[model samples]
Each structure stands twice: as C-alpha cells, then as structure tokens.
Target chain A: MQYLFFLLAAISVITALVVVAAKSPINSVIALVLCFLSIAGHYILLNAQFLAMVHVIVYTGAILVLMLFVIMLLNMNTIVEVRKPVITRILAVVTGGLLFLVLLAATKQGLSVDVPTGFDPGVGLVKRIGMSLFQDFLLPFEVSSVLFLSAMVGAMMLAKKDGTENVNLPPSSEPDLRQAGPNDSAA
Target chain B: MENVMTAIRVVPLEHYLILSFLLFSIGMVGALVRRNIIIVIMCLELMLNSVNLLLVAFSAYHSDPGGQVMVFFIMLVAAAEVTVGLSILVLMKRNTDGVDMNILNRLKW
Candidate 1:
C-alpha cells in the first residue's frame, strides 16, 4: 500500500512538472492528462472509488479533451511558446518556492492531528456521498446547475461572432451598445 | 473492506499534504511563467486538481462524506469555469491573431 502511494505520488509530481516545463502546448496537455490520471490513481489508493472514477471522467475525459480540441482548432500544437525573460522565469520560480515554504510552515504544526477514531471505510462510497449531496447539500447542488447554465450561456455569447458591429468593444459593453443602438436608429 | 482500511492506514496524511502542496506550487509557477494562454489555463486546472486531491485525502481520513461532496461541487464549477475560459481563449485568438498573454495588456480594444 505504501509502495502504491509513493508510486502514484512520484508519477503525479513528475507529470505535473512536465505539464509545466514542456515547450509545446500539446505536450503540456498530454502530460497534464497523465498527471490527472495519476491523481485518479491516488484517489483509488485512498479508497475514494467514486471520486477516482469521477476524477478520471471529468478531468481526463472532459476538461483535457476540451483543451485538446481548442488547441487543435486553433492550430496551436505546432507553435512553440515564446519563453519569458530568464530573470522573470527565475523570479516566478522563486515566488512559487516561497509560497510553498510558507504553506509548509503553516501546516507543519496542524498536520499531525491524531486520526479520528472509528474510521468508517464506507464513508467514501457513492451511496453515502450521494445521500449527503442530495440531502444536506441539496441547495448548493441545484444552485450549481444554475451556475452551469449561466456559464454555458456566457461562453456561447462570448465565443459567437458578432458580425462587423461592435468588433472593438469588449463583450461586457457590447450588450449596452446593442441596447442603445435601436433607440438611435429609431430617432 | 479490510483492505481499504489497511490502505488508508498505510500512509500518513502528511504525505498527501506535502504532495498536493508541491503540485500546487508547480502549477502556480507554470501559470505565472507560461506565455501561452491555453497552457496558463491548463496550469490553473492543475492547481485545482491538487486542491481536489487534498480535500479527498482529508475526506477519507476523517471518515466524512462532506469533503467529497465539496469536491463534487468544485468539479462542477471547474468545468463551468473552463468552458467560459476556453471560449474566451478562442475569442482572444480570433480577434488578436495570437494567444499570447502579453498582447492583452490593453484593457480596451
């Protein structure tokens, strides 16, 4: 069990680094998919079978594929990203390292809490999570559906061509222009 | 069931925390340094995944379903966020002819 955890952890860390360091966007996306798959492995090792499956499906299946589609559509796969200045890259790495250090120090004392007694291995099962979602988190669950609807509409509105009109205006201001243009035309 | 119990006990929770923290930092640095907008978004997804892993680890350790439920909502929101973000990316590419973040310095077009 320990070996599995270490193996998954190593895979996740390495693939995540590759996701960051790869020069081409396609390579990064591919590495990210592998990283996410390893995370799913971690979930399974932790006995969250439902989460493992969901992670695999939602992340690798949906999000990564969507990213790949966009990359392919834009023909961005062949474009090697222009590197930032060396100093800026170094500064960014330094900032990230500092952030990690702060987080580690903050959690150093808090992470040693005793494991709660009466560990129920079944708590991670789909049935319990489903009940909790439908009962206790019902409002949030329904609200998330509303959120998804709005996001879908917003994405469509943002991505669709607006013809030649309002080509220069941001999306947020374009609606106001549309609202005002009819009045001007009528006058 | 016994196997599951043994598995959870085999590794300390601290290791999970360290692993996720490392992943999060890596994502953060990627988002910061990457010039391409799509790779930046991908790094953001990486950060979110690290958080999900931590939440699930805690949920499993504490024997609580709440954290896992939270993870579900997070995934939903993440999906929505990615949809909108990528659409914006496509729009940016269409209008600007390039997806480089440096070109987006001017707020007004």
Candidate 2:
C-alpha cells in the first residue's frame, strides 16, 4: 500500500513537471490532464472517492477541454520562442530552488508534531461531505454560487466582440490601423 | 481497509509535503521563465493542483471532511479563474494576433 502511494506520487510529480516544462502548449495541457489523473489516484488513496471523481470530471473533463478549445481557437499550438536575458533566467531558477529549500525545511520541522492516532475513515465519504457542506458551510456554498454567476457574466462581457460601428467606440481608444503615412511608401 | 489506512499512516506525511513543494516550485519556475501567456496560465494550473494534492493529503491524515470540502471550493474558484483568464487571452490574441508576453510590454513604461 505504501508502494502504491509512492508510485502515484512519483507519477503525479513527474507529469506535473512535464506540464510546466513542455514546449508545446498542447503538450503541456495533455500533461496537465495526466497529472490531474494521478492526483485523483491520490484522492482515492486518501479515501475521498467522491472528490476524486469530481477532480477527474471538473479538471480533466471540463477545464482541459476549455483550455484546448481556447488554444485551438487562438492558434497558439506552437511554442512561442522569446529570448530572455540569461541573467533573468538564472535568477528565476535560483529563486525557485531557494523556495523549494525553504519550504522543505519548514515542512520537516512541521512534521515533527505527532498526528493524533485513529482517524475516522468515514469523514471523507460523500454523504459526510454533503452533510457538512449544507450544514456547516451552507452560507459559503450559496455565496460560491453567486461568485460563479458573477464570473460567468464577467467572462461574457470581456469576451464579447466590440460593436462594429465606430460611433459607439470611445474616441482615441482604438488605434487607427488604416493610416499608412509616407514612411510606409518609402519602404 | 484498516490495513490500508495503517500502511498509509506508516509513510511519513513529510514526504508528501516535499513532493508538493517541489511540484509547486516547478510551476513557479515555468510561470516566471515562459514567455507564452497560455503556458503561463497552464503553469498556474499546475501550482493550483499541487496545492490541491497537499490539501487532500492533509484531509486524509487528519480525517477531516473540512479539508476535502475546501478542495471542492478550490476547484470551483480555479474553474472560474480559468474561464476568465482564457477569455482575456482570447481577447488579447484577437487584438495582437499572437500570445507572446513580451509583446505586452508596451504598457510597461
């Protein structure tokens, strides 16, 4: 059982690294899906079966498809090769390493505290979670629904195409692409 | 089932913490170094997942339903964030014809 835990954790970490470092955006998204799957495995091992299913459905099913559609629509499949100064790249790597070391150190000290023995396994069950969600966290749950509604509206407003008529467009906000000066003729 | 729980408990929680930290750091590095905004967004997702892993681990170890419930809330917010973020990216792509982050430096001054 411990071996299974280690194996799943290793797969998740590797796939997560691939998701971050993959050159192609499409490849990165695919790697992210695999990483999420491994995470679901972890959830199952933790006995949160319902959360595991939700993780797979919400992440791998809905979110990944949305990302892929956006990528396809935007035609951003190819890696955009931008040259960054060597110093900044080095700095980023150093900072990331430093953060890892700091976090690892803190976590080592944190694990020294003894965990209470004999946990109730039923707490992670779907029925328990549902009851707690409605009873203890009912207000926050309803508030989250409101948050979702607002996000939906905001997304729609932001994504809507600008009006075709120039009359409605605020003056000087839109750059004039039609103006080609004498400098263009010189070329 | 009891045997499985005992086996899981035998493994120190510190290992899970270290793994999550490493994953989160990798995501941070990608977010910092990558110039493509879409890849940056994906890295952000990676970071969120790493946190989710930690939450689930704690949930199991502590035997608290609250942590798992929080994971659901986190997923909700992550989904909403991705929706808005991708919409903004789409808008940028429509206007700029590319997704390169450096090209966005026009507003930096």
Candidate 3:
C-alpha cells in the first residue's frame, strides 16, 4: 500500500511538472488531465471515493473539454509568443522555490499535532456526503447554484458582440474581432 | 478493504502535505512564468487540484466528512471560475488577436 501511494504521488507530481513546463498549451492541458487522474487515484487511496469520482468526472470530463474548446477556438500558438525577460523567469523560480521551502517547513511543524490515526471509512461514502451537503451545508450548496447562474450570465454578457459597457475597459481600442469574424488570423 | 485502510494509515499525513506543496508551487511558477493566458488558467486549475488532494487526505485521516464537503464546494466554485475566466480569455483573444499574456499590458499606461 505504501509503495502504491508513493507511485501515485510520483505520477501526480511529475505530471503536474509537465503541465507547468510543457511548451504547448495542448500538451499542458493533457498533462494536467493525467495529473488529475493520478490525484483521483490518491483520493481513492484516501477513501474519498465520492470525491474521487466527482474529481474525475468534473475535471476530466467537463473542465478538460471546456479547455480544449477554448484552445481550439482561440487558436493559440507559441510561434508568436515573445519570451519574457530572463530576470522575470528567474524571479518566478526563486519565488516558487521559496514558497515550497516555507510550506515544507510548515508541514514539518504541522506534523507535531497528533491527528487521529484511524479513519471513519463511511465518511467518504456518497450517502454521507449527500446527507452532509443537504443537512449541514445546505445553505452553501444552494448558494453555489446561484453563483453558477451568475457566472453563466456574466460569461455570456462578456462574450457577447458589440458589448460596449465592458468594451470601455482598456484594449477596447482594438478591433472587435466578431466583426472581423472568428478565423481572422487565428494563429 | 481493511488492508488498504491500514496501508493508507501507515503513510504519514505529512508526506501528502509535502507532495501537495510541491504541486502547488509548480503551478504557481507556471502561472507566473508562462505567457499564454490559457496555460496560466490551466496552472490555476492545477493549484486548485493540489489543494483538493490535500483536503481529501486530511478528510480521510481525520475521518471527517467536512473536508470532502469542502472539496466539493471548491470544485463547484472552480467550475464557475473557469467558465467566467475562459469567457474573459475568449474576449481577450478576440480583441487582441493573440493569447500572449504580454499583450495584456495595454491595461498599463
């Protein structure tokens, strides 16, 4: 069990790295999908079966497809992408490394707290999660639906053609591409 | 099933924390360093997933349903965030004719 856990962790970490470092957006998205799958495996190992399934379905099924559609729609390519200053890239790495080190140190301290060693196997079950969602977290759960609705309307409004209110924002000076059409220099 | 539970317990929770920290940092670096807006968004998703993993681990170890419940909420919010964010990205791409993050500097003076 320990070995399997390590293996899954390794897969997840390496795939996450690939997601970060891959030059192509498509490649990064693919790596992210793999990373999410390995994470689902981790969830299963952790006995959060319902969460694992939801993670797989929501991430791999809904999110990945949405990303692919956007990628295809936008027609992103690295050919035109200008590299950032070396100093900025270096700063980014340093910042990330420092964050990792600090968090690792915190984890070392966190380990000092005695967490209950055994798990209640039933907590991860779908029935348990559903009951909690409806009973204890019912308000937040319902609120999230409102959040979703608002997000949908907002996206639609933002993406609409001739939407001048948001167009007043910077970069509105650029030609509205909807008039030029979708395939206009889509590289 | 019983054997799997024992196996999970054998591994310290701190290991999970360290792994998630690494993943989150990588995603942060990617978000900071990458020029493509799409990739940046993907990195954001990666970071969110790392947190979800940590939450699930803690949820299992503590035998608490709340952590997983939180994960579910996070996923829900994440989905909404992605929808709104990608729409904005699409808008950016449409207006700018490219997805490069640098092009967004028009927001500056």
Candidate 4:
C-alpha cells in the first residue's frame, strides 16, 4: 500500500516536470492533465473519493480541454523561445526556492504525518465530508459560493461589453428598441 | 489485504516533502521561463496540483479527511479559474493576435 504512495509521488513529480519542460504549450497541457490525474490518485489514497473523481473531472476533463482549445485557437504551438531577461530568471528561481523553504518549514510545524492505517475508504468517505460541510462548515461554504457567483457575474459582464466596445458601436443616438427579451439584451 | 499493505509501505515524511518541493520548483521555473500566457497558466496549475499531492499525502498518513475536503474546494476554484482564464485568453488572443506575455506588457503600462 505504501509503495503505491511512492509510485504516485514519482508519477506526479515526473509529470509535473514534463509539464514545465515540454517545449510546446499543447504538450505541456497534456502533461498537466496527467499530473492532475496523478494527484487525484493521491486523493483517493487519502480516502477522499469525491475529491479524487472531481479532481479528474474538473481539471483533466474540463480545464485542460479548455486550455487546449485556447492554445489551438491561438495556434500558439509554434511558440517563440523568448529569452527571459537574466535578472528576471534569477529572481524567479530564487523566489521560488525561498517559497519552497517557507512552505516546508511551515509544514514541519503544522503537517500531520502518521503511518497510514491502510487504504480505508470507509473512514473519510464523501458522506463524511458532506456531514462535516453541512454541520460545522456551512456558513463559510455558502459565503464562498456567493463570492464565486459574484465573480462569475463580473466575469460575464467583462466578457460581454465595456467602454472599449463603445468605440466601435455605430453612432446611433436612438436607443435600439430591440433590447427587450432575455437573450438579445443579455447577450 | 494485510500482506498487500505490508509489502508496499514505506514511511519517510521527507520523501513527500521532497517531491512537493521539486514539483513546485519546476512549476516556478516554468512560470518564470515561459513567455506564452497559456504555458504560464499550465505551470500555475502544476503548482496547485503539487500542493494538492502534499495535502493528500499528509491526510492519508494522519487518517484525516478534512485535508481532502480542502482539495475539493481547490479543484472548484481551479475549474472556475480555467473557465474565466480561457475566456480572458480568448479575448486577449482576439485583440492582440498572440498570447505572448512579453507583448502583453503594453497592456500594463
């Protein structure tokens, strides 16, 4: 059972490196999907079945596809290898190493590491999570959803129309009376 | 089941930490080195997944499910982020004709 953990950890690390080092965005996205799947495997190992499935469905199924679409839409696979200015590269790598150290240090204090009691799915299954969410963590969950909804609405508005498009709108002082129904006006 | 469990188990919290560290470093390198916006986003996702792996490992070791619950929420955010990010990427591609981050600095200043 524990060897499985080592295997997964290895898979996750390798795929992640591939995601970063892959020369093309398309290749990177594919590698990223594999990385996500491997992480979901770890989730299942933790007995969080719901999270494991959702991790795959949301990230590998939807998000990676969306990224793929964007990459293809832009035809950015022929990526230009832009030389990252040396100072920026050095700063980024240094900051990244510093962040790793911080996280490790913090983790040493807060992380709970015990030997696994074996892969017991029944222990912390989805039902258990639901119980906890609805019981103790309800308020915070609901508030966060509201926040998410607002973010969605704001994003929709930004996508639909803003000041930039007004420059291209036909110069018609007459208000278009067609703005009546749900679809037309909304779109 | 006991036999199976016994054969494959090794414990050194340090290994998980080391793996997470390497994954995170790779992600940061990608973010820093890659100029294409899409590649950078992919790298960011890689970083998030690295963190998720760490959380799950810790949770499994401790026999706690709460960390997994957090993983769920993180996935939710990542989904929403991708949707919004894709829309923005599309809009940017339409306007700018390329997704290069360097060219996008003009949008900044």
Per-candidate RMSD, Å? 7.4, 6.1, 5.4, 6.8
DockQ of each: 0.68, 0.58, 0.67, 0.46
* Candidate 1 lDDT over residue span A7-110, tens digit each: 98999999999988888888999999999999998888778888889988998999999999999999997666678999999999999999999999999987
Off by over 4 Å in 1: A165-187
lDDT of 2 by residue, A34-117 (tens): 888988887777778889999999999999999999988777865466756889888998999999999888766666745677
| TM-score of chain A, cand. 4 | 0.72
Highest lDDT against the true fold, candidate: 1
Backbone clashes in model 4: 1
Which residue pairs clash in candidate 2? none
- lDDT computed for candidate 2: 0.83
lDDT of 1: 0.90
Cα error, residue A52 of model 1, in Å, equals 1.1
Interface RMSD of 2: 2.4
Quickly count the clashes in candidate 1.
0
DockQ, candidate no. 2: 0.58
Order by TM-score, highest first: 1, 3, 2, 4
Name the weakest run of 10 consecutive residues (lDDT summed) in model 2 chain A. A174-183
Q: lDDT tens string, model 1, B24-93?
A: 9999999999999998999999999999999999999999899999998899999999999999999988
lDDT of 4 by residue, A30-115 (tens): 87887878777766655567777778888888888877876887778775767678898788878888877887787777866556
